[model samples]
Target: MNPAREENPTLLDGFRDGYSVHLDKFDGPLDLLLHLIRKNEVDICDIPIADITRQYLDYIKLMKVLNLDVAGDFLLMASTLLHIKSRMLLPPDDEEESEEEEGDPRAELVRRLLEYQQYKEAGMVIGARALLGREVFTRACPDPALSAARTEEGPLEVSLFELVDAFRALLARIPKESFHDVAPGDSLNIADCINEILSLLQDRDTLQFDELIKDELTSERVIVTFLALLELCRLKLIRIFQNGEYGAIWFIPAVAPEQAGSAGEAVQSPV
Candidate 1:
């Protein structure tokens, strides 16, 4: 016998009194249910509710013993399983009983579990394909126009995650006091706003927040312009700086040819 298997012989045992000894590996209630179905060698099309219910409760007990942080979702599933089990156990009423109705009370549960399992397997397959694609790839050919554009400006340091976070923070600060109305074609195009900001930065080196918003505009346009600034920052084509508490932001263009090459090199190198 394998040493690992010998060390935990009871781990392979099938469900007894509706419970199994080997459910500790599961991360959630669905995982535990899947393990139980597999261990019993039972068809997912037809599940025995009473047996699974007892097994589920047994695992819950083990979870409590191990002091596992069981989520409410897990408890809710357990309650559902128990309810189905009780329904199965109750004697059928003479008037409601139908001979045509076939299969177990837990059939719906089995169907859902099987569907979830399929989706989970598909996700794994997709993830594996993504990993393979990342391993064998070619560098994109350099664009001379893009290079020429970068040569006119300096580099600025910023991260994509930071830019996204900053945008989220700006959205959170929008006042809920008065609802702003925006008609069709009223909202400014994000791309146009990006170009406008780029033009201002190109002319003045840096643009203050109030100066950027000085043009007559609705709140919706302001929000769109802010998002545009964030997108530019995310692309590493712009820099945003704030001085102190309640201070206005300064937006500046960042364009450097060598910096792009260095970023590409960094991605190619192993950590």
Candidate 2:
């Protein structure tokens, strides 16, 4: 045991004494393990089990002190590590011919750790990209489909869930054809629906509920169309309206050149 670690007791408690605590959050056991490995500047491919075991236990101890919820998965991993450490201490079985025949016990753990680290890094990159995309930017071309009042409201925003709902609606609208030899020659695509809605809004300026729905349209097409409309609204190209508590939904194109940057507006039909 390191005298310093013994003096500090808790894994993070040591940092409180003088050392800086850099990692504020960890996703799970793997994340915590990676943090410990990196902090100690230990090579992951050839982990020093004795050192890692001490540090891991210390962290677990700290978790107890903090009254943190100890998940079974974390405890399971700890047991696995301890078991590997114990196996390493035992002399090779007489039945085993050579050291090469008895593979390193830590091999599987090391491989998993490396793969998890890669995925974690990739997630961080993707998250950063999403954050960057959320930052508003000015567009060179002005959208003529948004209302002037709505255009003043700031750029429209839509959540990922809403986009998914729209997709589901589109999928539901698709017609089923039973003919084995006949593949339907034409069907509405999401992109095409988006473009279609934009064009409709551009020409009509406002669309009523009756005008928006087509009897020939499939359930999926309707949903895709709705999603496309939502997207357009997010882009500040359209505004939705309804009268009173429950009324027919109406979509109006934003007409101002500057209104293209306005916030999205949606009118939900009464249940």
Candidate 3:
């Protein structure tokens, strides 16, 4: 935690101790524009260029003040906004020239924003569906032992973001110029990685997040192992959890005798 943020709870509690992300967490220039539009409740098709541009510039200034690196795309968007604003101020040569030279300066921007908004909304819907799918569980006759275990461990599921963050932090610790046997056709497949994870859990009930990928010296292997971990969690073959906030995650085999027996019976039964 930064000493400057000690007094600000909101800064401390929000988004990983208010770690400044790419473009202050907005996906890109269009995303920032969309945010300003929605926040001001301004019509996207009829955006007030002067007002929105001012707000966008203000955000960029704040980013600079906070020492957050502003990407080239953001600056490019700023220039576009300024150009459009300048075009709006010029006098029209004639009705034809007016139509051709400065016809609705924001038309292209509006179209892009609309298309991006639709895809963003659709992504939200798909993400919600995925969450619902992960939440689905089989209800069996109550068992005191299982109930106790559930009570002891709050939830078996961890957010996918945390897993990605853990992977990134671990990856950062590796040397940038480390030697590797990464040849043209030497990439590790996710299936092989999955089998390896299962093999490890055979002897031990759980393994640390780093333990699984410690041997993956190359980026390709690390990525495949991460994907394999995600696939295992998606299939309910393993459970990821942490002891406390910002604690190391552990991947534990999700198989139980009851589940194994049920799986065996299902396989033996007629299709």
Candidate 4:
């Protein structure tokens, strides 16, 4: 797919999209629902289904925008959310059945979510192992610069969803009135953007994400730069870290050794 520089770009969560590649490696729909629930800091037992449904569908659109395979389970879960939402909207029955837990529209979903959370927590790997994945690129050795940067900054590693959230915030800071039209003569190139990012990462332990396009805030510019960042992460050339949740994000050069199989062998965090 071509770059998302057109006037009518596909948008979700404030980010534009044009790529059409399958990201089968990502998590499932329930995992995404869990993410949104946690993100909103709402009670899983009494989920705000309407709001959660909206956010869940937004994620589905985003997955499609990224050309990811929308697994059957995701669609099934979407319908389930909508069904629960509709049922919740109906007035409670006049009978005492309404007072029973079985009559609650959200009961089943709450049950599932609680069970899933238990399984997820049970399987959670400890420490850096939870932070690393096989899809990421790796190096055979560690770097003093990375160690030194960590010593001074003490930033925590972040997940891909967190990165997307930050990117959305970045786009929101730009005003619609300041938008620039992309001319064919100034087409965006992913390869060039990747090289530009590499140059920025050189001789540095951690690079500020916003600095990549600090000089240019156009939508096209931001979109291309983020895409490049995603590509780099996918290739395992760099890993992202944040000072804290909702804190300043930093990019650090990293490598995974061929024998890197666990936290004991690798240093980078997982997505």
Whole-structure CA lDDT of model 1: 0.62
Candidate No. with top lDDT: 3
Top candidate, metric TM-score: 1
Of 1 and 2, which scores higher on lDDT?
2
Over 4 Å off, model 2: 1-23, 94-102, 130-133, 136-271
lDDT of each: 0.62, 0.63, 0.72, 0.71
Q: Candidate 2 on 1-271: residue-level lDDT in tens?
A: 6676665464666565676654346678898889889988989988998888778877776777567777887888899899989978987676673635446889989989999999999998987773322453335323222232233453343344544554465455556652233435557555566555555665665675445556545554466576667666666566666432233456667655234322222222110
Ordered from best to worst lDDT, the candidate numbers read: 3, 4, 2, 1
User: On a 0 to 1 TM-score scale, where does candidate 2 land against the true structure?
Assistant: 0.46
- Per-residue alpha-carbon lDDT of model 1 for 1-271, expressed as tens digits? 5553343334323432346444456756777788888888777777777677667776666567557777887899999998787868887665566754343667778778988888778878987773322454434414333333343345333344544555556555556542465456744677667767665665676777656655644457557777777667666666775533234556665765345334323422321
Give TM-scores for every candidate, taking all chains together and pairing residue i with residue i. Answer: 0.47, 0.46, 0.42, 0.39
Model 3 residue 233 lDDT? 76
Clashes of 2: 16
In model 1, which runs have C-alpha deviations exceeding 4 angstroms? Answer: 1-27, 94-104, 130-271
Give the C-alpha miss distance for residue 215 in model 2, angstroms: 27
Q: Residue 219 CA error for candidate 2 (Å)?
A: 27
TM-score of 3: 0.42
How many times do residue backbones clash in model 3? Answer: 0
Q: Candidate 1: deviation at residue 268, Å?
A: 50
Whole-model lDDT, model 3 = 0.72
Candidate 1, clashing residue pairs? 18-55, 19-55
